[model samples]
Target: MNPYEIKELSPTGVLAEMGVEQGDLLLSINGRSVVDELDIRFLGGEEEILVEIQKPDGEIWELEIEKESDEPLGLHCDGGTLGIRRCRNNCVFCFIDQMPPGMRDTLYIKDDDERLSFLQGNYVTLTNLSEALKRRIVDYHIMPINISIHTTDPELRCKMLGNRFAGSILEDLAFFSEHHIQMNGQIVMCPGYNDGEALKKTLEDVMAFYPWLQSLSVVPVGLSSYREGLPALYPVDAQKAAETLDIIREAQDKMLAQYGVRFVFPSDEFFLLAGQDLPGEDYYGDFSQLENGVGMMTDFKAGLRDALAGRTPKSKGSHRFGIITGVLAKGFMEACAGAIEKVYPGADIGVLPIKNNHFGPSITVSGLVTGGDIVAQIPKENEIETYFIPENMVRYGTEDFLDDMTLGALSQALGAEVAIVPVRGDALAEAVAQRLIGG
Candidate 1:
């Protein structure tokens, strides 16, 4: 059934000004039943439109609208029109494998849809791409797409994706490259599985595509609490982390020297795990992969410095606050908190590292830190007036965390006012400044 029944409509153009009112259901647009907003956007911009409207009283109305190229119909639709696509692959290191059940239903959904990849920058493995879907990507010209290309080796890629169809990633990449379609790639580095020589080979293979491939992100694999039957997956220890860093650093240096660009970046987790400082800001040219945890630390530190620069000290008594983060980011967060405190004296901004009891110790990225894990670590009786959660935890415009717990519920349980800091450096510093200024 069509999810939209426009109650009121005002399209004052060459066509008649007619209203559908509150009891009307939007059946079809230009003879096609709209499945999603994408359909509406795709179909509604034509020179003439035929809308099939259905009344709640079981009557159907055919309304035709003729407008110039620039006119828009004031239409309304249900927010839940878009359906979530579930993932099919059974990869052992999937963070979703570790999630504790019995939360919101949406939390359990494992999405691998390219539509989301195009719309929200979510990464999609090409394993699920049908020929028709591939054609649509080319037809729609979904440029600047993000893909999960953990490895390029056919056999290893098949093993990594746990699907036979996954082995053709190179072919898919070739298709995109041939079409001049820009894309960013992600590798969820599993320690024994794909880290050492495998990672190097994968980088070499993908970087071969050059400018067609925009950037590559190498993030440490996350393990949640729900992995009982999955294959063995281990976290990268300090030694392995250092070795990975060394190998990647050399590769990055060579890439910079040869291509005039650092084609690959290991996420902030690697630097923190290896006890190495983040790369200089200039190393992250344009920060295209920041959302994937690349250059995030550098961006955060720079943001804090600018936000607190030339700022006034706390007006009166102490106002304590805490920012929760994953274990890998503990040191960086502490240093930034200290810097902020230095600028504004008498403000105790503590950096609290929330251990991953939900996803296991292997997962150390901040984006996967659940509310339950955070609530478990942070003390209730602390003098801190408010707790800051990373905005990355929640879907934009929604209170739901990736794990399905609402931020409000977590805040209530913890007895603290929680504010989600925007994922950017500037927004994060501004969040701190606002709290300091009592805003």
Candidate 2:
């Protein structure tokens, strides 16, 4: 059994009280070998635990700890947080496989780790699960795991995922369902593959799990322009998007009548592509799949309405700012800008739609828009004093775009201060209000 090295210990934690210090190796918890933080969390949750630690000077310490069941041990371990398991299956519609070369190395990592699914809400295919891992999950009671269930048909799943063992997806789903494990599911709908009857079958099959399986999100496959030698795949066109929504609506009606809740939902992209108005907030039932682009537009619009209602109309001399977004969200951003302008009469907000040249024009989400495209596409004659870019445009925890362009570089090129605004409508409203009031 491999031991995890204790990187840092909380000053007031149980470990600190037990004389455990930094650089000590955490050997085991209650006789079970500690694999990662998850193991520590699951096994160390008991009211009484036997913790084994090894010192750098070859001293082994066995510390018996007694604490409240809900109290955390509060010790940070090195390389124990993200023991990320790499993906095994080569799915035909994998977005990472379609990424352009020579970008950030982390962009290409294919993670199908269930640990990530539980920790970060990343959807994982069950193709990589071993019996030991399954036992760990069941024993640990890792509730509410997100699963990428593209299809339920055994043969079809194997073909789509390019994994011979992928046919066991239904069995995996059954295993979790039988064990009373709570889960959320995702289906990446490929145009001609799983869009029609296959999607219906998948939905029907998964619906058997009901409240335990919970909600499922059906998002269209993202096809990038870099798929040269890869399998030929078609984008979900306007017609197909409409057809897919019809199928989902039919399933939703059935599920609502049977279960009092719509168990399945189509993403916002489907509605945008189908040229249909977004559904109201009541349809989303807590916006569980907001990160998956389901009901995002409706939620944003609702938030903006509430935010605008709370603000007092103010006129601080005429101040202009640009709202930078991707081509697909141009109209949406324009509408948002119009609402902000109404609240702050002195604010002139122009919506600038930057074409996604780096990942090809087909990829239209604002989150995927590269900084290189923004610098190249912004009009040279633009007189905007500042630009409000969505926080998603930059990588998490940093102000750098996918193309490695720094926010400072963008500000310098455009001759304007760039402000990173959160994706929420209230945040945008607050940002513009502060800027207007300050100037």
Give TM per candidate.
Answer: 0.85, 0.96
Models, CA RMSD each: 3.7, 1.7
**Per-residue CA lDDT of candidate 1, range 45-76, in tens?**
77699988777778888887887656766665
Q: List residue ranges in candidate 1 displaced over 4 A.
A: 1-36, 46-82, 312-317, 400-416
lDDT tens digits, residues 148-250, model 2?
A: 9999999988989999999988889889989989999999999788879999899989998878898999999988889998888999999999999999999
In terms of lDDT, model 1 sits at 0.78
Among residues 3 or more apart in sequence or in different chains, the pairs in candidate 1 whose N, CA or C atoms overlap within 3 Å are 5-24, 5-25, 7-21, 7-22, 98-224, 98-225, 98-226, 223-359, 224-359
Candidate 2: 10-residue stretch with minimal lDDT: 76-85
What is the alpha-carbon RMSD of candidate 1 to the true structure? 3.7
Off by over 4 Å in 2: 80-82, 310-312
Candidate 2 Cα lDDT to native: 0.90
